[model samples]
Target: MSINKFIKASIQEEDQEPSAPSPQAESFSDFDRAYHSMLCAGCSCLCDDISYYMKEGHVTRTLNLCEVGWKRLCAVSAEDRVPPPSPSLLSDTVNQAARLLQAHPPVLVLGADNADEAAIRTSFELAGTFRGISLPWAYPGIRRFYERAKRFGWATGLLDEVRDRAESVIFWRADPLVTHHRHLSRYSLFARGRLTERGNLDRNLAAVASHETVIEPLCQQFFQLSTDQDSALIEALAHPGGGGGLDHRDLPALARALQGSSYVALFVDPEKVTYEALDAMFRWSAKLNTEGRKRMVILPLWDAGPNIEGFCRVSLEKNATPWGGPFAKASAGTQPEDTSWEDLAGTVGSVILISSGVDASPGNVLPKGLSEKPRVVIDPFKRTPALKDQVVIPTALPGLESDGIFFRADGLPFDVHGIEVWRNHGYPTVRDVLADLMSEGR
Candidate 1:
């Protein structure tokens, strides 16, 4: 297919720091099938128009897939997708997986933004099983927004809602086109939606981000921003002049646009927005008194890790934390600090890795130094950076192999699974394996 078609069919994905094997020669055989339309929620692109080609639990070819999607599909394994099956000790591996939870009191499970729903559920099950903290590693900009949202319960809508009914859509620190590929085609620029049957110049797309980006022709306005989801505008709003800070040259224009917008929708990843900025937005939204023509919606451009939201919902419903891993919430005295993989070095005990998605091989996130302790990997591809594990359990990639639902960036529910593969129930979901491990009671 042409690159444009491939791009359209692509699923936008964030960078997964792990290293893994190259696409397999025998990855897809004769038995697998292809799936279309379903999107991967690993990133904000939320490209729903995607296609996958698979063969017998493996992906052979892909259409309309992004780099991340192709990598994710290619990473699937049909057979026992685990580590090297070390020492003939399944029991020990299981025990270690559970014990890691038990020992790491108030475990803070991170990096679930790119994971599928099944994996997310498994993580939550583990958390509940162990009672730990599970925080989905979404964009840091939205942290303030999420925090305020948890308290005041802000209003929200979907991408389509903005494209259809909203007069304005503010994409803060995010580019859906480059990352999402089909977002413009499906919802924003050239596409059609509920109120916009013949989408052309009906809705406005405002990009507030760092660096010069490509959607030049379609955007109504552009605001140069920091790559690190900055909230200088909010600070400016609070302290308009007592100011000795960054200059927001076009901020006045942005605020004017918002004030003039009859129906406004802010599409942002809460991780990028600051507490003050988000609070200001919230206050502004409340004052707008959205009733009919003057409506506002705030869509948190969320990206689910394997099971981040799924696990979070389950954790809340079940009142359980994700893992017993070290976290600030559960720890009595010590707090879990954000340490890069480089700093983790030799402190890591037995490693239990689950190559969650197509983003990258989890090895990149592991410390460069070896732990010497036995390693356990859960994935289908035998060759990858996570390859050093003493045991390899080939686990099936969930979306194509099994069926389940995952939430979108706006917390709206969507299905992640499709008939992309032809698989018998022999290969179980990661949740089942973790469930068995948790059952053994570490």
Candidate 2:
């Protein structure tokens, strides 16, 4: 079937009214079956309650998947999927990639944000083997927040806990309506939990953003400020007695919401605010917990990628730093610090990118000179037009075409099981390609 038809069928299934019967109501033909408890890697939520029906190797119906998740599943039949290369061509390409690394002397591995845990580890191992550095794409503020949380302490809990017990929710610089479509309905604002029986009605909702967001209407209090005012607003909220010389209209209402609620969950998107503001917010949350008068937790909102959390976890385990680095022994014990593409662009000779579900071209997302360097890209989709010097290896899409362990944004791990339909593609996984490259180098 064509990609358009596949997408249309999936959307029609998703648009079925809430009153419709279960998908199981349909007859099960020999080629038709249902799979449940599948995880969606479209975002960091890693929503695991997804169920779908496959007819003759195509997804005909689905349940509990948002648009993001639906598109991800439809990506299996996406037209941009890289065509499988012949065995001899693949071997030659792997050899070429190995030669590039050997000649470059210090490869910069990128794009682990969308890979599985095993693939992330292998990327690190590949970097170590080549005397290179493995850097995954992530928000700078998130790395800063991790460092601060380590030193000052992080008063955070699982999303499930927030759903069950949180009495107040403050979306500070977080726009879940756009970034994480199911986050509010499944975990935070609208979810009906044991204690939050009435969902949004039972909790006080507030939002603090530089501009208007879709979530503002649902919030009892909305604080709209300019980008420059974030630090001052956080400062004022941190120490209400001081006032911080910030004349904000919604300050009093925001303060009242926090003061009245016993349990507060403050969700902040680090990308939208400066590090100073994030640090101040963290300190303020820590202070609230220290006072023992109320329970306040800071939950960061950002989509570095679905498994960026896995990258951080693996980096911490292997390199002793959340940011992937320490290529030399001298920096082995160095403290964790934020590393951006700009930091590594001039230092490395070549790059090895392992990405999945990324639609942007390298020239658009990568640093200036880095895109011009010799590179090897392992991805399920064709990212860029062919270049004689560059090597592009096709791979199976993790969580849809391959099974692996992926971490949600909350740092919880879930096993992603692939359906059997796409196994015939005969494409290697990121882990497989990395393993081949490592072997070829030896």
Measured by TM-score, the strongest candidate is: 2
What lDDT score is found at residue 97 in candidate 2? Answer: 90
| Candidate 2 collision pairs | none
Q: Which candidate should be chosen as best, given lDDT against the real structure? A: 2
lDDT of 1 by residue, 163-268 (tens): 6776567776656655555556665555676776756455566777667866544466676766433555644433444332556566666556665667777766
Please report how far candidate 1 places residue 8 from its true position, in Å.
12
Residue lDDT tens for model 2, 1-442: 5534543453454445234355566666633678897888878888888877777787777778876677666667877766777788889989989998888857888888778899899988888788788876653555677877887799988899889888889888888767777787777877888888988777888888777886776677788887778778888887778756798677887777778778889888776777677778788888999999998988877756778878888989997877675634212333334334555565677888776455656655677778877888887756466865678888888888888999877788988888877766787788889989988877
Q: Which stretches of candidate 1 lie over 4 Å from their true place?
A: 1-63, 77-108, 112-119, 128-131, 139-143, 198-200, 213-218, 226-260, 290-293, 303-307, 319-329, 333-353, 366-377, 380-392, 418-421
- Give the Cα error of residue 270 in candidate 1, in Å: 2.2
Which stretches of candidate 2 lie above 4 Å from their native place?
1-31, 327-340, 356-358
For model 2, the run of ten residues with the poorest summed lDDT? 327-336
